[model samples]
Target: MLTITATLRCQGGHEDVLRDALLDVARHVAAHEPDTIGFFVSQDLADPCIFTTYERFADQAAMDRHNTSAALARCFATISPILDGDVVLLTGTELSAKT
Candidate 1:
């Protein structure tokens, strides 16, 4: 399985907008991407403008597909302008899990 985590900070006064856009992207993926095993978005309690997303896919191909997906492009279209900076991404291979 391929796992990726991203952290982003919203531009001033745009936190809600960023969160909404992320939700839309999650919905689209849930409805259309079979190889995406998990996608989750969350806001940091200590810093509400900070958002983090966790994405899990079947493999590199699945991740590549997601990168090229129109849904993701649409999401970035809405999210980019409101972002404070480039999203931080971390990638890894899953070693073990119970769930």
Candidate 2:
């Protein structure tokens, strides 16, 4: 499996917008991307504007497909203007067993 974790810091007061946009992205991925095993979005309690995305894909190709997806592009465009900086993406192996 391919796992991607992204930390995004939104500009102050833009947290709600970012959260909504991320929810849309998650819905789109779940509906259209067959290889997407899971996609989750969460906000940090210490920094409400800081959002994190945990994504799991079937393989590298699945991840690649997500990068090129229109939904992802739209999500980026929607959130770019309100972001404090570039999203921090961390790619790693999934070591935990799945239920």
Candidate 3:
């Protein structure tokens, strides 16, 4: 399995808008991608514009497919301007799980 965690900081006053857009992307992936194990978008309670997305895929190929999906491309295009900085992507390994 492969896990990806993305942390995004939204421009001041654009938190809600960015959060909504992320939610839409999450729904689209969940409904259309069979290899997606989990997709979650969340907001930091103390820092309003900070958002995080946790995703799990079956493997590296699945993650690559997700990156090439139309839904994600569209979402990135739409949310680019609202971002405060570059999105931070963190990869993780499940210590007990096999790829």
| Cα lDDT computed for each candidate against the true fold | 0.90, 0.93, 0.87
- How far residue 99's Cα lies from its native spot in candidate 3, in Å, is 18
Tens digits of per-residue lDDT for model 2, 1-99: 789999999999999999999999999998999998999999999999999999999999999999899999999999999999988999988999565
Q: Give per-model TM-scores.
A: 0.94, 0.94, 0.91
Angstrom error at residue 93, model 1: 0.6
How do the residues 1-99 of candidate 3 rate in per-residue lDDT, one tens digit apiece?
789999999899998789888988888887898898888898999999999998898898889888898888888988899899999999986456433
C-alpha lDDT of candidate 3 relative to the true structure? 0.87
Which stretches of model 1 miss by more than 4 angstroms? none
lDDT of 1: 0.90
**lDDT minimum window of 10 residues, candidate 2:** 90-99
Name the runs in model 2 displaced over 4 angstroms: none
Q: Lowest-lDDT window of 10 residues in candidate 3? A: 90-99
- Please give the TM-score that candidate 2 achieves against the real structure: 0.94
